[model samples]
Target: MSVLDTAFVDTELSKKTSIFGLHLWVVIGIVVGAVIVLIPSNLFASLPRAAGAAARALPEIQIDMGKVEHRVVFSDRGASSGESRATSGAETGSFGDENVIGEGGYGIVYYGMLADNTKVAIKNLLNNRGQAEKEFKVEVEAIGRVRHKNLVRLLGYCVEGAYRMLVYEYIDNGNLDHLAYLHEGLEPKVVHRDIKSSNILLDRNWHPKLSDFGLAKLLNSERSYVTTRVMGTFGYVAPEYACTGMLNEKSDIYSFGILIMEIITGRAPVDYSRPPGEVNLIDWLKMMVGNRKSEEVVDPKLPERPASKALKRVILVALRCVDPDAQKRPKMGHVIHMLESEDLLSRDERRIARDSSSSLREEPSASRLEQQTKQ
Candidate 1:
């Protein structure tokens, strides 16, 4: 494990008030170049304590007052010498127009290469007064020590005067991976308030990484939900969260359900260009299922049709996720199990399958009889 550079720790700065009152030691140094290392999740569990008893908190980011530079601290245990990382003086980040890759409400992402030739996405946060600072803190504290194959990694951050930026592993494409990791894998569950398809990023090999934590909330073990202002993409918001602003893991499941439907059918959550009956994706999907037209709901552009049973199973999962009652939704882990199971048909789906087969067998004869009567 790479130790903290003691050279950056100043005696006078350690006496100052902790940044954000988190009992963090405000230091004098900032991270320079990128250090790419796949750290074990448990590596930070045994970090040495700081000056005070409250300073024993590990896996949490420490920020300074003036030039706020945040870094992820790791423990030496379980880390091999081959995985050693080196930290240096602050390196320059480029933001030329040619490097711009993506833009969002709060920041513009510019593609940059580190001194070690590692590609990274530099999130230049729009100087929106306190909003940028709040987002920076949330992201750093949230995923600073988080190491998951499906979640984007936060390398480091820089806060100098009015300018603020976050360094992230640059993902080539975007797609959903495992919400189960956030909802069940972590100690204090993380609720991704925004789980729309767009927030999910994919690498060159199509591995997905969940991105954007500006609206993410950490729910403690004591509480099941967090009451906050309703914030998310329009149409993707869970009904309960939208109506009452009470958010929980179920809210994310609901959004994931919408995302699943969006993928199955090549349609937006709400499409004004669609006919009146098909304006809302969920409502239209329910109508299609009610008419026994579930097979027709799959996107026509798919190169080959999915197996009947497989398609039905996916639809079942999606419907369960978007259930009107949030309590009825399946947990992320359960959803993963259902999706991966070979025999995925529920009792109701079995009955539907039988009915669909009967309908298919009778269709040609019924049409023939009608034609004979007309002749």
Candidate 2:
């Protein structure tokens, strides 16, 4: 069994064994409960020294406290004497759905104002663990220095006691997690290791700006590929990257293909709500293509059916983008070319157009000797 399967089996078996040993467990539980009842209540209370030591053990990511103070406005409840606070008012600063911009793995991004009334998106990180702290620094150092028109700029950060937060320039339309946002042309060669719908954000002009650089890797002049631990959302990960941990721009291409299909179908990569055979997007797509029922793959909720030719081209491009072999996958620029070209879905058409093409060319089957011929 695979490691993941083994882990799952062991967990399920452990649960079943616990259930079967209920009587013995109950007896042991009673003794443990009696022993706990005899122990002092003070032991259960907060142990500040231990908590402090644990927090201090991890390498601290430096933050300019002066810059953070300008944007982070803590209320009386949020801050205490000798702590950072914007005001002495008992009410908390604006940070909610009413002013809520977006949400991600890190935390809720709130539309809020700085002391100078500058509009900002404040990400309130929910986790305070050491690993989470590293992610915080990763995001800050990764995108904080660079200024790009297509990327949401990280303005500053705040770290007070256990609370950690980041401030970003607010994008009015929010994110594409629900596949609800659509942005115009954005051509960046950067490989977003995690390219799910949620990581895309729409601006005031309906332009999509990619967000969440926490899992992103820059393919600079120095290097274009790396072999590391497989990391990313399941359905969007490339077959090559998932199997061998070999990552490059094509890995993101594979994920982008999945994202396009997500936009087309309004379906997530994996959904238990779907039928057994239709649970996975790629598997379902292949099944549909094999059955020549590709038309059925489009989301029924769409207001109007897209032209068959246009739709076919889209599906063809998506299929090519997700080809199993990493070498066969097209660059993002070429994928864009296919999307814009009409009647350019088939290999023959693309080949005639003088565009570079790759194939799923299968190997010939080995010949087996017939009984009569052998005799």
Candidate 3:
């Protein structure tokens, strides 16, 4: 209606138009920014799915024998055949010398070196083809998924048409049995069931490592509790498990307890040279322990002195481990703690007396000394 009002209206219209244009530019910038951020991610996310689908669609090739059909499982891209040694790099040899460290009734152990120079222990089945093959597969599958510091590591495997082998981390020191028995000149009183010094290996620092899973069963697992054919070394086998064929985790604990005792006393579970009354190391230890004399059970090579509390605690722990009833024995975790802790248990007086007797024996012979002095 008025000229001034008309001019003001036109200015307001121009401002509104400019504001709308700015808002539209802002919306466009946001859309462009989102596209820049999300496009690459979406493309990358779809790649794995697409590759997997392509793989699934590809025809699977199989080799047919008279009655057996074998499937080739692809491990890596560009791998021509599955027969290639699972080892990394191109280095190839029989590995017979490098891997073969020791032998036993069941298998032979070899020291294998990987491409990265990481050493591994390879156990090759010497006999029992079917059992070895099954064990190799079971171990690979079971150990691959399980991880623990105390347990040995499984690296890889080799199966060349009946030549079955398992690869594991290489321990520099031989098995625990050797240190406790052969080298120490002591007899192992423990029923390892499969007890031979070769089963236990030592690390570079001589820390004991338990190996040989071929016969190992997870004691806690229900599957392992089932009755099976009796198979184990005579000396290490628990009386109950050996006789009844009822093997459980306690069987392993019993064996471990015996091992601990052997480590402490430096005597075999069953020794032919020992007198008739002292044939069984466990029985002998029991008698000495019951009579309050532990020093008599200790290794002769060990120095004769007052029975330290440390020695008593170790003996107690060993006894607890070898309890006739598996239910009463402590778990490996507790055993490890008792071994490490100095204050957990106390020493017996008889042990001190035995130590004193040993000390007297070490002293010079009085008659011989007098004769030499006169001469």
Candidate 4:
């Protein structure tokens, strides 16, 4: 944990009073964030009481109070070379209105082009209750220095008082919540709590980009679980996270499992239109996989050939990810391995074995791993 300066703590806390008698925890969260900003990134592995308590809170950013500048520009680059198109909200009144790509709980995303004709998606956060500020800090903290082909780029940001905005490279298609395929890279794991299809966006070449960092949580390399409030789409949430507030990388695996089912079956996680017992994808898929009738749940529209080999493998991996017991679930590495394997059983071969089975089998989800002890 980074050390906190006692004098600095007294100075900042004295300046700001909790207007609404906000909970001590919330105030402490801010104090912790303030302290974190004064330290180095490598020291983030261990945070003191305040920071550890508020798992979702971001480290405080140093704003130049003297300038009182209407526009605040924060970028991944050391120094922004020219007038940025994203900071227009501070100078004028709008980010960009030419095209509205999408809108969500965080803010509205606009499609625009920069001076060099570089296309970008600018997010102007609705600074309603400081949610935008937290989102900006978290996104920058989680992904600012990290780069991956599968992840969306966090190009820049504008923190002009009440106006908090983010700039990202525009994705051609929508979020993964629109598309249904993607898994996290667990080595230095970043859990995208809300893993619905809409969060998955597609680029010009059709590669998926994962976006939205408001509800994201970064796990320290040495830690196995992060304790925090459970926030995510209802159907896509892992059972363990929903029941208990404990979350780890497996939580993402479970959501990915649900996503796979959605991709293959063309069904949402929760559909009341379906039969009573099978309303939840988790429950329905469990029944299908156990009955040795996994083939029954595939999307009818998926062409026959690839669906048999690739689709079955996809479903199998999805099932592994969604396994009710977090411990029983396979790691993302193992899941990917299975997905790419050629010799895995085909639908017909697996069905033959299922037909001869005398009794029902327990799947990872149905069997349920013993409740995990809080880490």
Q: Which candidate is the best by lDDT?
A: 1
lDDT of each: 0.55, 0.51, 0.46, 0.53
Question: Which prediction has more favorable TM-score, 2 or 3?
Answer: 2
Model 4 TM-score is 0.61
Q: Candidate 2: which pairs clash?
A: 183-208
Global local distance difference test of model 4 = 0.53
The sequence of per-residue lDDT tens digits that candidate 4 reaches over residues 1-375 is 111224542354334333212222112221221121122334324423353443332212221223333333434431121122222223332333546777765578877555556676777666345445554465455444455555577665655546665667777656433243343443455676766667766576645556764345777789988876667777888988988878887887787777767866767899999889878876777677556555577666433323333444556566656656687676665555544455554455344323323223544322221111000
Clashes of each: 3, 1, 20, 18
The local lDDT score (0 to 100) that residue 344 gets in candidate 2 is 33
Q: Report the error of model 3 at residue 307, Å.
A: 3.0
Model 1 stretches astray by more than 4 angstroms: 1-97, 104-107, 115-117, 124-139, 158-164, 173-183, 213-215, 344-375
Quote model 1's TM-score.
0.63
Which 10 consecutive residues of model 1 have the lowest summed lDDT?
27-36
List where candidate 4 sits over 4 angstroms from the true fold. Answer: 1-99, 105-107, 112-117, 124-139, 160-164, 173-188, 213-215, 305-313, 344-375
lDDT winner between 1 and 4, please give it. 1
Work out the TM-score per prediction. Answer: 0.63, 0.58, 0.55, 0.61
